[model samples]
Target: MKKNIWLDGLRSVARMGETAVVAAKAGIKYATEKPSNAKLMRETFESLGSTYIKLGQFIASTPSLFPREYVEEFQGCLDQTPSLPFSYVEEVLASEFAGRDLTEIFASIEEKPLASASIAQVHAAKLVSGEDVVIKVQKPGVETILYTDLNVLHWATKILEKAVPKVKFASLADIVEEIKTRMVREVDFIEEAKNLEDFREYLQLTNNQAATAPRVYHQYSTRRVLTMQRLYGVPLTDFEIVKQYSKDPSQVLITAMNTWFGSLMMCNSFHADLHAGNLMLLEDGRVGFIDFGIVGQLNPEVWSACIAFMDSLQKTDYQAMAENMLKMGATSKQIDTQVLAQDIERLFSGVLMADPQELLASKPSDLNDIMMDMVAVGERHGIRFPRDFALLFKQMLYFDRFMRVLAPYTDIYADQRLQMQMDPSLLLKH
Candidate 1:
């Protein structure tokens, strides 16, 4: 216990130093050259240790909450950090497995990691019984580091929220709170294992042959280590590879979209982070979803409101849209429906009036514009949206961009393949 306390103190000191250095570096770079703000921001976040790394990931996932440049730039901030040496991996393995040799359980384990992130690194291995697996090993002391960093961040955010009201649309406190929730969950590999299994089962039950998630080996898994099947595929961004495998790349994309849209209603939680890196096209013409570290859960009430919002968007019912958002997100502060609708209309009126074919051809993504409008609306009315609604809206914005890239000729809102309906029990029962 004394050792643990000492370690925590050391972590706190390290985090503060790191944060300062990162902040200084960012300030220097911004002052010296007009570098891409998104790139500089991501680099600074990476330097601030695990908490900010996770925050960068969240920003990469949430297009609706940030500007387009930031979202697109942070996409490069994948788990690309250097891994701990193999000696560290071995020490962790022995300590966790009661001094047993890795060979005792695995027939073979690769020294080279398949991928390394801020918190963990994955290695390809085979179980002694001959099953192929990918082992995800957590870096030592990551939990302590993450905890200390988040605590410091909470204080920092509180200070910033008081000092700067408009650094970005989101208050520093709210953003830090959201980051804490996600980072805590990410530090536990067991939870991710469960998420992987649940998603696999959901796909199986739904007979979703178009896509497949990896299978987890729960027996060999722990809070720090996860063993799962390795999936081989090219990321969806490689249109050339996708074309070589499938007759039509757009068909694969549609299947992926349809599968995800269905899961939003049927599954308990859906994969909230579906960037090009996380999605792939396998050799067998199936979409592969990798990484379940961050999933989003929609309560029944919120799900109902989301359905209403999507339907309203399709029908251009701005009043209903405003009402649904208020119910789903706002904290009791009344917003004038007519005023909100008028604001929304003003924001989208030009885009809507453009020829449908032109809209499809140009493939205009309006997530940043929409978020700016939302911020305007929020400032006009004292309605601060909860974090969950912010996350859902971010996912919707990502889907909108994905559809534009995959099928630019199709109207994403009116896509017959995407299912937006809700189950009766979800809304009414809860």
Candidate 2:
């Protein structure tokens, strides 16, 4: 045990030294070329590997806390990662199922990965029972690298904040801590399996037949290997294929939105990352929600505040929106609701007045810009939203983008199908 600890310590030191060299080179290049800071940071994160790649994705999703350019730049950080060799993947599977026979557990697992990301690679497999599935296997040494990289990142954020006080607005240290908590949970396949199961249960209980999450095979799953029911489908972003699957793609968006909104109230946690890749149009015309790695849990008070905020937005009640925003966030000092209302009204009125067609043209980024503007204004009033709130808001923005593509020129706020109000009975049951 002591020798293992010593080896780990040595590895951590080596990783830190390597990171420092890479960062120094990137910094010198940035200083000389005067390229956009967002581009430079994105490149640096990509070069640094898993932990930074995940961080970049977080930044991309979190428009509520990051600047528009940074958020836009990091959007490229989705799942663009190099794959590990089949031998390494086989080694991980053997280690994860040490005593069990691989042939007994899985009839066959494809040598080539179906997909590869920072932490894991997925392979198409068939079980002994003749069921098709996918096995998500964690890469060797990823946890150690994650720990070392996050420690270095946390340290760097502290130093940067101390050097530049202006960068302290969104609280970089708190964000890093939040990332650490989520990423740590992400590496644990057990928790992700639970998330998938819970979501599946929520769908069953609600009789939501239009949308589904991948069914987890708990018997074959472990901390490092997750075996789930294979969902064959094209991505939701593949509009041509989606149109072929569903006659009215607009209804697909509606079904997805309603199902997701129901989960917010019914499930223990909500899917925080609902990018185009995570959502798919299945072979049977059902909307498939996959990738339960990152999720958000909101307390009752925050959830109530969120519902109220959405209700207020539908009604254009800026005062109510401001009050709910205060309820949803934390601050050391009190803020004036009236002033906050004025600021929100001023920011949103222009967005609300824009032609729907033009808004649809911009789609995702337009809504992101509006949310960022609101965050900027809220920051001025000393209102800092919780991480959960930001996650929820980001998902909402994603839905808004989908709406533009599926139901062009539709007003999401006033849509009759959208249940903006939370059901009191559902709240009590939860």
Candidate 3:
């Protein structure tokens, strides 16, 4: 009952603040001789707090599903806001550990954060035993804010859907459910610890050294606190630094691609979020993966269908591609495979004939043109791709974009270029 009272009071305050914000936004738009809408939105979201920032990050990550304007605008919302103070950090640590002081276990901790996202901020530290580590502390009251915001957002979405009929197909409630599942998982650092350990085991079993995930110190970790081995490197998006390590950036890309692709087949879950920020090129010449907040798993049937879809794309077998896509996606009715094949072939014939490098350019117009074509094809076939498939497809599109910046000449599908660093014994046999 107390919790309900607190939540109700929070919602009332939020609604009042939201009304003021909306009014201010309206006035800003009306008087706009020069208006930076993105900046305004970012400031408003920051004022609104954690939930909006988290949603902004989601929009930035999901390119295929959102508008170009929104995607480009939200890219600036990568948690540049000020982090909670050291006092708050100490409080979180104390709360999680129950009366234990941070200095008791760690010889030193740098209050300056390495990275600060919506949910948590990471700090570099050293254990008393002399191990260099990074501590991730969940900001106080973030979960409460998230729950409150989610509830309010759900109500707003329902209201918006009622007013706008076109969005009825993509139910707002479903999107909220998906985001809630992922966000709740993110607040629990213990789950991230497990994900890191499982990924480490996967790498060991595969004998892959092209990339490295952080090592978790489970003893000191909790739902709100995490201690991991600190990694030093450049973000993978830094082409200039990546070129310093390898003469052929194309090979570096191929290794990164194959390493991640192999995990989909060999591991229980695959990293769903592989944006450039989450990937790093370490000084030791290894890829560093950080942030395991969102992941994807596939049943065997879906996995088989995905493999078949890839094989078909490689073969340029449109009929097989259509079949695999149908099997992989959800459909309300049986569709004609032959017609779908014809539609896909027509859409991609010109595209497939072009140099892959040309297609990889992330020019907004170029990407929009292709996406519009896919929607057209979907309309013709009476088939809608599932959100999971769209998520994977968008990741591939970003991979293509990265290839343009990191490696121009690489053939992503060519056999000589497509080598998996994990289990190179197969390479020796070939």
The most accurate candidate by lDDT is 2
TM-score of 2: 0.89
- Residue 358 error, candidate 2, Å: 8.3
Sort the candidates on TM-score, descending order: 2, 1, 3
Q: After aligning candidate 2 to the native by TM-score, how far in Å is the CA of 240 from where it should be?
A: 3.4
Most TM-score-accurate candidate: 2
Candidate 2 per-residue lDDT, tens place, 1-430, comes to 7986887888888888889888998989988998899999999999888899999988886766787899889978755689999999999899788899999989999999988988999999999999999999999888888999988878989899989988734488888998999899999999999999999988887777889888888889999999999999987666677899999887788788888877777889999989787898898999999999989987667877878886777677889999998988877898899999999888877787744234334456676676678777888988877667768877887886677667776666556887744576765755
Q: How many backbone clashes does candidate 2 have?
A: 0
TM-scores of the candidates are 0.82, 0.89, 0.82
* lDDT by candidate, in order shown: 0.73, 0.84, 0.72
List model 1 lDDT by residue over 54-96, tens digit each.
7887776554466767876776675678777888887767767
lDDT of 3 by residue, 192-240 (tens): 8888887787778767888889988888999999999988878667678
Q: Listing every candidate in turn, what is its Cα RMSD in Å to the true structure after a full C-alpha superposition?
A: 4.0, 2.9, 4.6
Alpha-carbon runs more than 4 Å astray in model 2? 1-10, 61-69, 157-172, 300-304, 350-362
Candidate 1 residue spans exceeding 4 A from truth: 1-11, 24-42, 57-79, 158-175, 300-304, 355-365, 400-408, 411-415, 422-430
TM-score of 1: 0.82
Assess candidate 3 and give its TM-score to the true structure. 0.82
